[model samples]
Target: MTSAVDVVVVGGGQAGLAAGHHLRRQGLDFVILDADAAPGGSWQHMWDSLHLFSPAEHSSLPGRLMPAQPGEAYPDAGHVVDYLADYEKRYNLSVQHGTRVDAVRRNAGQLMVEADTGTWRARAVISATGTWSRPFLPATPGREVFTGRQLHTVNYRSPADFAGQRVIVVGGGNSGAQIAADLTLDGHVNVTWVTQRPPRFLPDDIDGRALFDVATARRRALEEGRSDTGGVASLGDIVAVPPVRSARDAGLLSVRPMFTRLTADGVRWDDGSHSGADAVVWCTGFRPALAHLAPLNLRGPRGHIPTDGTRVLGEPHLHLLGYGDWTGPASATLIGVGRPAREAAHQIARQLST
Candidate 1:
């Protein structure tokens, strides 16, 4: 059977939940379609030791605050998952779980979302499907032939999984740094960190909270016709979370330049040095999940949908939430995502109402 709504949100994570909050406040008929069987979105899949760089207060959705668990300074992945589940119930947002949207296409001036279970015909569609599902591994030569246990951050569960295994963690981002630290600190595995460029650590005081504030300022600056924030930091850089800090203090954190190529057992550096490792953990990040929207023919060669803010350039009835900085600066974060989501909801509500 086909369902219909005024708007259909394509994800149920923080982004979709944020959008749902505004859509509810706007009193619009909307339904959130979540691919996962449960409420946590991608957080549930994160490594067990993963914690937000910011405190619970800094990581929150639109209408609710993330309450910290007892004695926990920074919220862990499970905390986030529980909070997300609670957020949905607290707001009474309409969500259909396990509804993986296979494609979104224009149908008679409305967008039709084709999912695994059924179809949703809506006046407007908000594509909040974030990048977690689409992990990107750099095209390194011999990677196809490397006969080791290759895994990405998405599939990574815990350091115990790699116990006593010589592992190479690739990428300079937070995931790369954090996993490397986790493995090294546990003293169970040898981890070699690799990045294309040297990793930059934000100031000790600078956490995800500060980054959100900076992103907000930058977004506000652009909106108010200002060009710069006097030098806003790139959100892509790593934040010094507690474990990461501990790793640094213990002198366990070290990095290497990107490898020339992969070998059967390990990687080969440009200087002809070879490092043999048992497993390679790719924290190389992800591309935007725009495959469902491909039917709209909006994706560019870079696999991104060009947007004037959150709205697609030519497709006025479609808006993309979450994803990444291209949608809005730091729009993927729990705190930073609300701005674009609210904006998108407002825009869609206005369009549907009129």
Candidate 2:
């Protein structure tokens, strides 16, 4: 049996929830399809020690402020999970949990969203599925020949698993830095953290809230036809979160250049130097989770769907949210997703009305 609605949101995470909030305000009939079995989205899967770069108040969805956590300036993953669960209930959003959408395609001027449980036909579809599922591992030489265990950020849960082992952590982004810090602070594993380039740490005074402000200012400048101000990228990459700062200041977290190739038991650098390791952790980040949209054939040569604001270039009926800055300024972050989500809903409402 196929049900119909004005809009079908393919994700129940922060982006999808934000879209739902605006769609509700717009009086549009819609339902958010979440792949997860429960609320919290990707937050629940984050490593135990993971914490937001900003306070709870700065990291929130639309129509609600995330409540403060007592004695914690930066909330951990568990706190975020609880907040998301509460946000869903507080707003009474219609979510079909555990319904993973397999495909989305056009059918007689309407979009047909297919899932294991059922199908939905809608005039507009919002692809808010974030990048958590699509972890990107770089094609470093001899990776296949490496005899040691290798895992991506998605599979990592805690430092206890690597206790007493020599591990090499790759990548220079926030995840790489954080995981390295976690392992170093845990005082269990011997970690050799590597990055493609020298790790850049943001100023101690700067945090997620400040980064968001920079993104906002940059976005506003561009929309008003002003020169580019470089935005968040201008400052640095890593946020210098508490753990990272502690480890760095104590000289426990030292980074080396990326390995030239993986060996049977370890890695080799370009200078012919070598190190032995029991495991290698790749925190190389992820691509957009857009496999479900393959039927649309909208991707460009660069492997990304071109967009005019939130709307897909070739398919205006479709809108993508929370992938990255390409979708909107800082759209991938919690506080940043609201603007694009709101705009996407309003655009969809206007389109459906006509």
**How many residue pairs clash in each candidate at the backbone level?**
0, 0
Residue-wise C-alpha lDDT for candidate 2, range 186-215, written one tens digit per residue: 998999999989999999999999999999
Q: Compute the lDDT of residue 67 as modeled in candidate 2.
A: 90
Name the lDDT value of residue 341 in candidate 1. 89
lDDT of 1 by residue, 1-354 (tens): 898999999999999999999999889999999999999899989998999988998899887889987878998999999999999998999999998999999989999999999999999999898989999988889999888999999988888898888899998989999998999999988889989999888888888878877877887898799887842355447888989999988889989998998899888999998989899999999988878888899867665568899999879999988877789888899988988888998998888878
Candidate maximizing TM-score: 2
Model 1: residues >4 Å from true position, as ranges?
230-236
Q: What is the C-alpha RMSD of each candidate to the true structure, in Å?
A: 1.5, 0.8
lDDT of each: 0.89, 0.93
TM-score of 2: 0.99
Error of 1 at 329 (Å): 2.5
The alpha-carbon deviation from the true structure for residue 270 of candidate 1, after best TM-score superposition, in angstroms, is 1.7
